[model samples]
Target: MSEERVGFFTDTSVCIGCKACEVACKEWNAIPEDGLSLTAMSYDNTQALGASTWRHVAFIEQPRPEGRTELPLAQGESTAQETPVGGDGELRWLMSSDVCKHCTHAACLDVCPTGSLFRTEFGTVVVQEDICNGCGYCVPACPYGVIEQRPHDGRAFKCTMCYDRLGAGREPACAKACPTESIQFGPLDELRERAALRVDQLHEAGVTDARLYGHDPDDGVGGDGAFFLLLDRPEVYGLPPDPVVTTRDLPAMWQHAGTAALSLLGGLAACFALTGRGRR
Candidate 1:
């Protein structure tokens, strides 16, 4: 609306698996701390995004064979030929910080029975806690599985895209806290352009797998206020490959229902008319 406001441009390639963004978000937003128990699933303490954890850092470790054995070398036997060092064939770590997408056509906003969820002038979606009736309609409406109900309050919550900070003309705390600038925030259009250039740069650097996700304006949800640049498939990062807004089919569904209702009424009227004629 206002020259297309900016949003996040997370470069997963630069993320160092640091939970600083996660910690900062919790600290600044006064979010409750989730359990510290580790799932032994990589180094990620916070397994995923939830009511308490907004920013989740995913750590992925890939292993590659160091050598090519001609005759299936024994467990302890070293191959006579050295395979290679770190290169195209070598394994590397891929880290990404996941957060609410703030979709353009947010289904959560559409499905909210109350006006708890609404779009801001910045075109970001926000849930008004005071207005939320805790009906939980928004929880599943989100295609990205973002908004969730708090256990204690039963009220839905999610990242506000740091609306207060944006209002104060300050960048989101997570973006500011990122040491490597992995999370950059600005106007959505500008961020998209920047993300595209970053993808190109990564490709040129032989990181051919680097690509942008959720940045397409023509995408199912229109586009996302917060998008990402990833080094692997979205599902590898626990994100959906193709997220269609759940409410996209609502209009067609209603139209079909209306047609069916009309046809039924017309049939009833014809039956009544034929019966009346017989009575006459």
Candidate 2:
């Protein structure tokens, strides 16, 4: 293990809905373009992060409360009484560049029968294309719905956090191409401290809703290598509110199964002993 662990800190508040990260990822990784003609997803045609879509720029337009609804007024007064909106009332555009969480206890890595998915020195998870047998075990194991099989090739694929770039001491392609520095990459510990300061600053500036997601080391999946500073609830950005690793109970389940098997054998042995006594 490397002494230093690296990861991503995506400050979604600063994202400008620019798909530069998305394009750069595909270009640098040589990923195929998907759903070129699909029209179902508005603004974000790439949709959620998947096999080919490594970095998905999500555009969310939240409705601002109707400005100052007028109350009934007397005929002679001829004036509209303005209704005050609560402090929560606000309007803003939210843009987040979504990518693989690369969880510390990555379920995908846990479920890979061939060991194709493994953690790198930087603590980011990667999938070895050649080693993948396309058994599809990893697809359902991922809590974030990341890591999908390429239809044509039947091989699972996802963001490797640009492991190749990191090996060369360079930032991930998406982070490098970001014009707003929305995607910042560095040592994981340093990034967490930086993200905390950013959230505090936003709160001080009256952006009370700004909060960090997936930064807690003790979170469900032991925190994500790529965490985010989300302006709204995670689900609003198409992310799960509380994601838990699917295989967290495997050990307990196995223990119970083993105990049950022993109990059944003991019962069978007792029956055989009783029959032998009768025969004697």
Candidate 3:
């Protein structure tokens, strides 16, 4: 579609712990290796999205909770038991490759001093490496903590939504390389519709915790370009359950500051008038 723009709709329910997306992201972006040492945690060595690691696949291992299904439990065990089936229980690993949300009301864009970070016609935010100048203002400005400054160059980096590839009418390297189609890239509108349908499907399949994150336009960050269908609370994925853009209150804050200044000036003037009368 000529008018359609590209975006990501990550279905975390079916993500199978493959790190192919992470590999594709690093390879395509030419991002530096953050070391291959195994983490004490699960299979995830790369913890999260940073300057060196643009796409991080999170691995969470947990016993599948009961009570959501109608199946009968084994002898002497009730379905509501939080304990595992065996002595340890059946373990399942949830995997999701995380990236920059490309938020609609991006705080990074709001706080950038240089014109390096700009919004494209596709409605994605990207930083021009040459123009960044290592200000580091965009780091904390992001509510999601998705962007970061590279250790070597100090310039900030995150997912660009593959601007160059999108311009060439191709999918992002991560999406293309994904084996299970967990990371699906397409027009945002269509993806949202599809995500809703998939959520319904999951609900029918007894996965009632299935919910969409960052899909609504009225959300805190005005929605995200790269949203997800998470299987649990957002915190399970290390995301803020309710993330408002950091600068959403800028106008109101400035107004309050102005009022406080006026109040202080008025108090000082009154003091001066009383002092002058006493001196006279």
Candidate 4:
């Protein structure tokens, strides 16, 4: 029997930016530690996803309400805006956990020269590290810019959606560790149904900005296996507003190229025949 399609429904509205998902991911995957450096970009230290960093949580601090007090600065700190505060002003801090989409039409799988990227029985995407040649084709083919080459190993890597855990009938570590149930994992169809109801509930509660991203089967990437319910614009969480599969137009491009080449060859043959006749 075919395994049901399992995936993630990351509800950004409920995420607290605690980075528990990040920690759980690294622990389960045995990924290298990344606590060495501070980039001075908000509370975010692990900036983006890579081989070592499978799950990244983005922190976006929105300025307080208009005519609010100027944010106080530390004695020796930069004068830039401080952490968002809602006590005296209407401040909103947006936090989101980003992962590989495991797209329905996976561009990484299409561009993997070594056949390292493969689809799982659960309808997720995974990469075989030993089989990877590190060609880096999949890096650019991904519209979300999720895949990356490890510095030491030079092998492309991203979230596997915890294929191993799924096989054992367990949820991905990140989802299991989420304190707010923000990162929900289950059958894709069921999640979609549940997410819709959540959105409706939020709307009824006067949260007009609530919306779902990457859930449509007819979307550009044919929909993401791991989708999201966002309270703000996708860009607010460092997600592309519209992600399109990079390989969607390859067949049409090749067809046009072949037609042009055939036309050029026919013209060359005609010229050669005419020259031969004149010489005779």
TM-score winner between candidates 2 and 3: 2
Ranking by TM-score: 2, 1, 4, 3
Query: Positional deviation of 204 in candidate 4, in angstroms?
Result: 0.4
RMSD of each: 7.4, 8.2, 5.8, 7.4
Listed in order, each prediction's TM-score against the native is 0.89, 0.89, 0.87, 0.89
TM-score for model 2?
0.89
Residue 157 in model 1: shift from native, Å?
A: 0.5
Q: Write the per-residue lDDT of candidate 3 for residues 79-152, one digit (tens) a residue.
A: 33233243356566777889999998999999999989999878889999999999999999999999999878
Alpha carbon deviation, residue 55, candidate 3 (Å): 0.8
Clash pairs (backbone) in predicted model 3: none
| Error in Å for residue 122 of model 3 | 0.6
Write one digit per residue (lDDT tens) for candidate 4, span 2-119. 8999899998877889999999999998888866355586888898887778999888888544332332121223233333345554766778899999999999998888889999
Tens-digit per-residue lDDT, 1-280, candidate 2: 6747889999987788888999999999999889854446457788788898999988887753343333112112323334555345464568999999989899998899999999888888999999999999999999999889999878999999899999998999999999988899999999999999888766554456778999998989999999999878999998889889999999999999999999999999999999999999
The residue-level lDDT of candidate 2 at 30 comes to 99
**True lDDT of residue 196, candidate 1:** 87
lDDT of each: 0.83, 0.85, 0.84, 0.85
Structure candidate 1, residue pairs in collision: 5-187, 5-188, 6-186, 6-187, 6-188, 7-186
Model 4: weakest 10-residue lDDT segment is 67-76
Give candidate 3's TM-score. Answer: 0.87
